[model samples]
Target chain A: MIRQTLRMARWEVIKLRRRWMPWVFLAFIVLSSQLRLLTEYQMYSNADPGRIAVQAGPANEEGEHSTISISCLDIRDGLVESRLSGIPTEFRQAALQEVESLRDRCPALLGMYDFARTNFLNNATLPGSLSYGINMFGTLGYLFVMILAAMAIGVEYTWGTARQVLAKGCGRGRFLAAKVLGLLAVVGIGHLAVILFMGISSLIITYTMAGTGISTDVMQWLRPGADVVKSMYMMLPYIILGTFFAVLTSSASSGIVISVVFYISESILRWIIGSYLGPDAARILISVNTPLWMASLEFPALNNLSEIYNYLRDFLSTFLPILAYIVVFWGGSFWLFKRRDLKPSTGV
Target chain B: MMASNDLVIKTESLTKRYGDILAVNDLSLEVPRGHVFGLLGPNGSGKTTTMGMLLGLVRPSAGRFSLFGGRKPHREALTRTGAIVEFPSFYPHLTGRDNLAFFQEISGNGDSVELDTLLEKVGLDGRGKDRFQTYSLGMKQRLGLAYVLLGDPDLLILDEPTNGMDPDGMAEVRELIRSLGDGERTVLLSSHLLHEVEQVCDSVAILSHGRLVVQGRVDELVRSLAGETILLRTTDNAKAIEILSKLNWVTDLNSKGESILVSAPTLRSSELSEVLSRSAVYVAEMTLGHVSLEEYYFKITDDANGDTA
Candidate 1:
């Protein structure tokens, strides 16, 4: 059985390698990531720290230079408050030591020093935007994975290969199992490629922008390794669900149609319910709700065990619906596929 | 001349239904070992359905069939049987060799020797590396036969194996099937072409509208019809017709100049000769007629007219 499974896997991999779609999707993801990174870099390039301080009010009362001085004072106070918040005592002390060293080296710009310290300290307490970007893109991976799964099974049926496979004495159960495993393996590889490309591209863009002296400390919030791992974990049930959808439908077009419709409906239902009935009721309607919540909860960083536990509670509450969906869809697909005649091209 | 241990396939009232239609109704047949058995039928005559049931690809609505000695299509039974139902389709992307190799693994036939010999036998020895999609219709048909022959199966069942092949290709397939019946293998092939079936089959079963109309040794079936037909040439053809007209056994009497052709009921050529000689008419030439399998098939299947023997 293991050998048979391995053989099927090998065949599936070969088929995927010969196909052009996976490569095309990978290229799209890479291009999209680069485009997003470039846009983000341009947005941050013109941002003025001085203007930001003036907009906070009372800085104009001090006149031009006095306003700079007042902004510098405000920056100092904000830094102190941020430093005293949740940071470890040792790290705070080290940070202060670094500030004193900077003061000694550049004594002429005390106002700028104070502002720098305040900005650094305040930003340290905030989650990075990079983490948010990773989390957002990670969620999108689920949809792409579904599309890949649909294409894997759908293409074979559309091309009339499933019938040829069945005619070889491979039982319907075995054949379906092979195709599912094949699709998952191919989709998994494609997902990894997208994740890797996005991770590398984002890192390069962040490094380049930071080299140009643009402060992008908030970019550290998106941890590539952690975000990818979490996203993949959340994508497991969705992959299974997508595969079931592909197997249940007779043609590729129908599978894609059904999966897209189902996913869109769930998203719309979740949005409507969340707006009207609160998050608790909304969570019960979306299959990916737990994953989304888990992803969001881990963003920035967990402050304490209690925060983590609360997030887990929310995730678990949302998980039951996804669990039920997976069970119904997977089991229903298996039953339907096993009994139905595999009229691949003739559209039975 | 039937061998005691000869029968390779035996079906008893085998029936199959597709919703309201009875596709194969109470089909009982016996195919002997080491003989090419032709399933002669037109479209929708249940030949493909019957082969499907025998190969365990289709479920019978009633009755039973056995391959070798097994009553059901067990793994052991299927191990010794290879079939190509309807149009033989394979993975078009895979090379013919790879396709055959895959079937070898599935059939659990590890003998590379058999595979090589069978490929060569079907004239597809070195062409196995070519992808199936690149192969012509004739090549695909031959490869289909090669796949079926992978395990050197005891019985080969093919439905319309030569359906789309040209005359030369059909002839080659006929020779290939005939070669399979040389010593051990029993081949059951279904075809709508009567001449093709006649060329290769030693025995044939004729099906009409889901029912078995006739079946037996091809020679016996043809000869049985032959015995009822006689051709006569006489110097006094008018006298011969006059004498033949008085007999109730003679029908379809045609007098062409000095020759009279008539289908006789039960009389042998020698008996007819003796009667004609006794009537004082010198029989110039007398010959026993042989009916082609096609003619015999038509005689049996056409609306039974008592006028034509």
Candidate 2:
């Protein structure tokens, strides 16, 4: 059975490679990663840092709002009058210290762009791109992986090849298991491509744009690597769900429709369940927990103890349910494939 | 009785039900080793259903079957068996050779040389590189044959394998099936084409309304089901019946509208006529006639239909 399954898996990858959809999906991911890197770098590079405007974000519950519209040069030159005038009274003192620090870094106008470039490099580079692409991979991988899983499983029944396979003594359970594993391999390779592509391209872009002062500790990647691992596992539930629907309905279209519908409807369902019920109810959703679990790692390690605590809470809550969904969907699919009589393909 | 070891397939009251419909009912059957066996049935007669059950595509609702004498184990038995239960289904995107290669590899015969040989055996050489979706129906059927021939399986089960093929393609497939079943291997063929079965099968089981109507060697069943008949117009019809009835080969002797119908081998028409003339019941007209498998099929199925009605 194991040998047969491996053969099936090897053939599955071969079949998928001969097709065009997976490559197109991977291309979209790789190109999108580069596009984002270029877009961010372009936004920062084109800015006139000498006269660039700065603004604070919206206020907290304590009404601590502050908006700074003064030019960077005004702050860089220690022109305290122009900078302090527009700032609100609640944030006036803290804003002064921040401007003073920037003034010290680029007290000369010639260094303002250099100073601003250094700040933007980290946001557009390897360590940042990992987190950035993790979110992107999860979102896009769910869609692509779900779509691929549907195609991989659905086409067997639609083409009546499942009959051919089972007739050849391939156990129905083994066939499905091999198929799911094959799909995971395809998606795994796709994710790896995105990670490598984004990492390489982001590094190249940062090294080209920053010129110098781009020192990143190797440890900075450890968190993003963990998130990457998390994002990869996150696509499993969708794969199983797609496989389940494909086998249950015995059509690729139903598999695709239902899986996509589920993928799309999940957020709405989570929102509805959460709104009328509560957030705890929403966190029960796999996709909902995924982003929260991913976002957990983004919480700073500084004096953000409570934020870290919430991150831990979401992480702990996220793991088991995602695993449970995977087990349920995969088990349901295997049972269906094993027990149900395999009819020839009815139609498209 | 054929030894149990000689039976490649044995079913004991095997049955399958889809809701209220009995797709296959108490199907007790055997296909002896190294014989081309025909499973003949009309549409919905459970021929394909029975094959499906044997090949593990459909689970039987009742009863049990053992493949290859149940000695080598189920999966191993299947590995030595090749089947095309319904139509030839394949990935439309794959080239014919690629599709063969895929199933070939999965069946554990990853030999490229064997795949090419099977493709050539099915007369699908050179055209094997074309995508399945682009191939004509005949080409697709040929590809299916190639796939089934992989692993050099000992037993081959084909259900309407020649469907969607031209007459020439049908003949080619028929010849291929006959060659595959030549002394060394067993072929369980299910086809609605009685003539194809007649030409290729060594033994057959005719199914009617999900029940076995009759089973025997093609020659025996065709001979016995509606025994060979001689239509005779004579000066003395009563005398002709009397004379022919006395012959040991004559199973039934009766008078029809204007002639005597003697149920005996049409091959012995000369002896029959000579017997009549010798008996002084001189024949004005005599013509040899016999029921073919087609005629026997309809006759038995109509009788089966009548029985249930």
User: A1-348, model 2: which lDDT tens digit per residue?
Assistant: 689898899889888988898899889887887687677667667756544334454678997754665555575556767656766665666666666555544546546566556545765676766667666776766877888888889989998999998888878888988988888788777767777877787767756753533336877767677776777678788889889989888888888888889888997898899899998878778878777656645555768888888767766688788888899889888898888988987652
Work out the TM-score per prediction. Answer: 0.70, 0.82
**Superposed Cα deviation of residue B293, candidate 2 (Å):** 1.9
In candidate 2, residue A301 scores what lDDT? 76
Per-prediction interface RMSD in Å: 4.1, 1.3
Q: Write the per-residue lDDT of candidate 2 for residues B9-77, one digit (tens) a residue.
A: 999999999899998899999899999999998899999999989988889999999998999778779
| Residue A235, candidate 1: C-alpha displacement in angstroms | 5.6
Give stretches of model 2 more than 4 Å off: A42-120, A211-216, A296-314, B226-228, B233-283, B287-289
Q: Per-residue lDDT tens digits of candidate 1, residues A1-348? A: 556655665677666665576667656655665566555444444333332211112225556321112222334445534533554554446545544444344434544544544443222222333343344434455666677667777765665556545544455566556666776676556556655555465455446543223244544434544655555555556666667777787666777777788788888888888889887787665454645644544432466777778777766665666667667766776787766545424421
Please write out the lDDT profile of model 1 over residues B170-268, one tens digit for every residue. 888888888888898899999878888888999999887788888898999998888888778876788888887887777657764567777885455
Share of native interface contacts present in candidate 1:
0.06
The CA lDDT at B209 in model 1 is 73
Docking class of 2: medium
